[model samples]
Target: MTMNALTASAAALFFNHDGEVLIVNPTYKDHWNLPGGAVDIEQGENPYDAAVREVREELGITPPIGRLLVHAWLTVPGRGAQVLYVFDGGVLDHDTQAAITLQASELSEYRFCPPHGMEDGLIPPHLAGVWQQALIAHAEDRITYVPVRL
Candidate 1:
């Protein structure tokens, strides 16, 4: 057994001027997600770099990423354990927001959602719960740890 066998992912939390968090609608999933993806360890990318890469690829903007906001772990049915990292992307300005260009093939749309009750159930509970906690941690100026159970 190799000690390095693990799956990891990185995500970012970007807020608009109205304090709404940015969420993306992936064409492959019914739920909206943060601008992030699995860490390309094979390509020598760390969690932080992966988050940056994902943001650039998915949103076509290169906003500066900040410290870690949320760290979580989830049990995958068949893929073993997965570690997830969420970074504080800070607030996007009008010019940065205007530069967003979604990857047409991967993402269908994007929106800035209120941190409270997400309108129309667009976000799943697992994500919503974690997101809410992340918001709380941000407000308190600290990092948050979340455990996801299936």
Candidate 2:
């Protein structure tokens, strides 16, 4: 059997004070990216848990899961499809000033980004819309309460 090239995944759009963003620089491709991954369609898998797991795996720290940030559909050049689950989280604690048990294979660096400085940062262009949506959700007060899709 073969798996579809397109896939659904969850990502975190963490934020800090003064309109800054939390980002992880992937060690795999040496590119900065949001923290997230594909869903595990198991017996009792939770999206929030998945998000927390991803943060721990990638950043060597725990991010306080605050609320549902927003949703995005990404389109990569070669990847067939990209449906992303974005969440708003807060940085609880860590020594970003130095290094933790960094996921050397997946992430090399992590940083808190000021809103204005992100223009020159190396994030996927496809995630621009995602960032916009996250901001909107945050302002509207709906970010912390995403409704279930039934």
Please report the candidate that would top lDDT against the real structure. Answer: 1
Superposition error at 28 for model 2 (Å): 2.4
RMSD of 1: 2.8
| Predicted candidate 1 versus true structure: per-residue lDDT over 1-150, tens digit per residue | 134357889999999989999999999998888889999989889999999999999999999999998898776555567788989999999999999999998999999988874645887666677777778877888999898874
CA lDDT of 15 in candidate 2? 64
Q: Residue 128 deviation, candidate 1, in Å?
A: 2.0
Q: Pick the candidate with the highest TM-score.
A: 1
Which regions of candidate 1 deviate over 4 angstroms? Answer: 1-5, 77-79
lDDT of 2 by residue, 1-150 (tens): 123354566777766555577777876654577777666646355667778787777766675677777755544445455556777775434354243356778777777787545556477555555666676786686753232221
TM-score of 1: 0.91
Once fitted onto the true fold, the runs of candidate 2 whose alpha carbons sit more than 4 angstroms away are: 1-5, 42-44, 75-80, 91-101, 143-150
